[model samples]
Target: MTSGYGHGLDRDRDPLRRYLSAWIGFSAGGHFSQALSVAIVLYAFSTQSVRALMGWPGSLAVLGTLVVLATLSLVGGRHHIEWHGILPVSLIALFGFMGLSVFWSEYTWATVGGVAYAVGFGALGIYLALGRDLVQVVRAFGDALRILLVVSLSLEVLSGLLIDQPIAFLGIQGNLAEGGPIQGISGTRNYLGFLATLAVITFAVEFLTRSVPRRQAVASGALALTALVFARSPATAIAVIVLIVAGVALNALRRAPESRRSLMQSVFAVIVVLGGALAYAGRSRLLDAVDATNDLSVRSLLWARIRELAAVHDIVGWGFVGQWPTEIFPYSTIIAPSGRPHETGLNAFFDIWLQLGLVGGLLLVVAGTLAFVRSWITASGHPIVAYVWPALVLVLIGVTAVAESFVLFEGTLMTFVAIATIAARKRSWRSRLPQAAGR
Candidate 1:
């Protein structure tokens, strides 16, 4: 019973420490995933002529993850593997492409890169969800996420505000009809809008779970919301606002007396249905209202184009990221000077649909949806933690579904799923501990 750190062999361990270590490890895994995803993306487009190559650090990181898995398997034995919750769905999404990949993909290298991306994202998501206290880990990760957003948003703002090269740097190539700083990251009013919505959602959830002063939370939330909006990105902000209202409405009903709770819930449900109807009816206005009109308008064009492309290659795809240029052409009117087409579809769903086809897209969507839903359900009792994080994740997923296909984007989605899995695992451990003691 010798404790590794101390002389006392019998000191009882703190569950919190175990939870934190696992959580941190899971978070680091996500960072690694992001770095890897970036490497893959950069490498995919990198021609031997241009010389955009991945360095030794990235190679070592990938090698390390493999080493860790190999060592873990060797020591713990492979049979100890546990595929918890929605992992199977992700596996199907990633590996199922193999069937189509065998025939359709023109270039073997591109196909390999595509598979690598899927495997990376799938592995990270499954590991986080099934193995890690992903809830707290996610909350902690939010801190870093916010900082990144702030930096990204700020960089975008400067490009739009202080600099003259708006098109190349900021990606706001078209006329800036709407006022304010240009949106960065995804670019365009709608792209920035969705990113902003995610920021607000993340901030709100973290704010609620935090033990910080109410004023501080409010100030921080307001600042984030402002910065997000300043980029003229409405999609992310709108999603956050909608989720907040939904969550608040749900909370109100839960705290109500048992008799009134049902009635309130029913009323809330009706409101949601009515709201949905209104949103659909005034989708344009709603988009404009949130300064996200571009998203609403462009999605239709992108969907049509992607569907047509998929029809041609119904099984696999045009070879992962390569399909983007060809498939996106129908939706895009603007051509780059380099002869590449530029269409800002701004929908993650379409991105996947074009890359993986119908079957893969469906499975990945289910898996991603389940990632948030599981977190939401597990954190139900801890309302502050459960509601916000899952809600934030949902908001991000929703926005991405419309604008970008992040299903196999190893960096962001993988990190999120990993944190979520960690949270769920912790809950399971706690529930079983007492039962095991009794036995």
Candidate 2:
């Protein structure tokens, strides 16, 4: 009997390992590939020659999202089917309504894109909820996020070598008003802060997994990549700082004095390396090149527009990604090259409200926040906090959008929601186990 029990344990362990390995591989490949995809998109839009031909294209992310979702529909079908049981019914209905809204919306393409995006994310939520095991899913997510940090760092290095511009990986136009570059894989400056926070989470996972010194060194290197952005993007820097402080405080509360020592030491080392890099970068002329873009004040203008836009079309909403009245809508409120705002849609919640109406928008907020917070709690103690950080970062980005929009791009929203669903599913699974006799 003892021998049979031990063998059963081994059998279960093997399947778990296999699942974890596959999940990690998929996540890592997806992360790096996403970076490459972003670079291609940015390079296409930024070039003057291309711009003349593309004619603004009105949210390339949305188009790209449609293409990705369509592709995933075929390849991801099996995965989607597997997740159907776990997804929330209300989200599905909302997406249906969004799709229907396209018929009446002035911006048909935007409406189509919005509905498609909502559907894609809704699908992912289902997958996370019913199709996968939570612990394995998170472990895989951690592994993948760690790889993403490496990929992001690699791109930064590559960009530096190619462009010879410090902080150019951020893709910032180097204008004081710009705050930071818009490197796709690395993301915008504030996005970089989100990325760095992921790195921090990765470091935590690495420690949890008992990684070697070499891995630690790699993570340290990744953290240093954000040094350039820290000085340039107050938003990103502030967010990163706050998260770091929060993480530390949380750990202090959770850990014993002696156990906390190692984490503190590791964190201090990261700060030293990243801080030194920032000090050096701050002195360079490159630091002054962030003025042309409208990152900092763009949100104010966007907020004003949202309020104005919402007032007239307040009830029915304006369809997803629909246009606002630029003339009476406070176009001048935006800071940029006549029309170039670093990130035009400064707020996401407002965008949703404007497009979906007050009732729909409120429901989405409640549902989305619930999903995010629930996922964070379910996955926090697990190994997936690394990848989960990016989703959470999206949540933070969404918060800022209370006045403005976010990755409402088709499959992106679904991707994170899918993660949330998986987290929620895992929580339920854990709850099913019987406690040992007494509490």
Indicate which candidate wins on TM-score: 1
Each candidate structure's count of clashing pairs? 27, 34
Model 1 agreement with the true structure over 1-439: per-residue lDDT tens digits: 3456563432445665676556445535545434433333222212111221345456436534643552332233224444443333344545666435645666556567556655555454554344333334444444444554565555555555566345453354432334565544444454455445555665565566663456755765775666555665565556656777766765665466666755765787699789879878977777777766655555565567667766776655555652233343332433434565643334666666656667656766665665555554444344355444654556456645655554345445555555445444444344465567899
TM-score of 2: 0.57
Q: Candidate 2's residue-wise lDDT over 83-104, tens digit each?
A: 3234444455556657767876
Clashes of 1: 27
Please provide TM-scores, in order, for all candidate models, with all chains considered together: 0.65, 0.57
Model 1, position 280: C-alpha lDDT score: 83
217: Cα error in model 2, Å: 7.1
Provide the overall lDDT of each model, using Cα atoms, as 2-decimal numbers. 0.51, 0.48
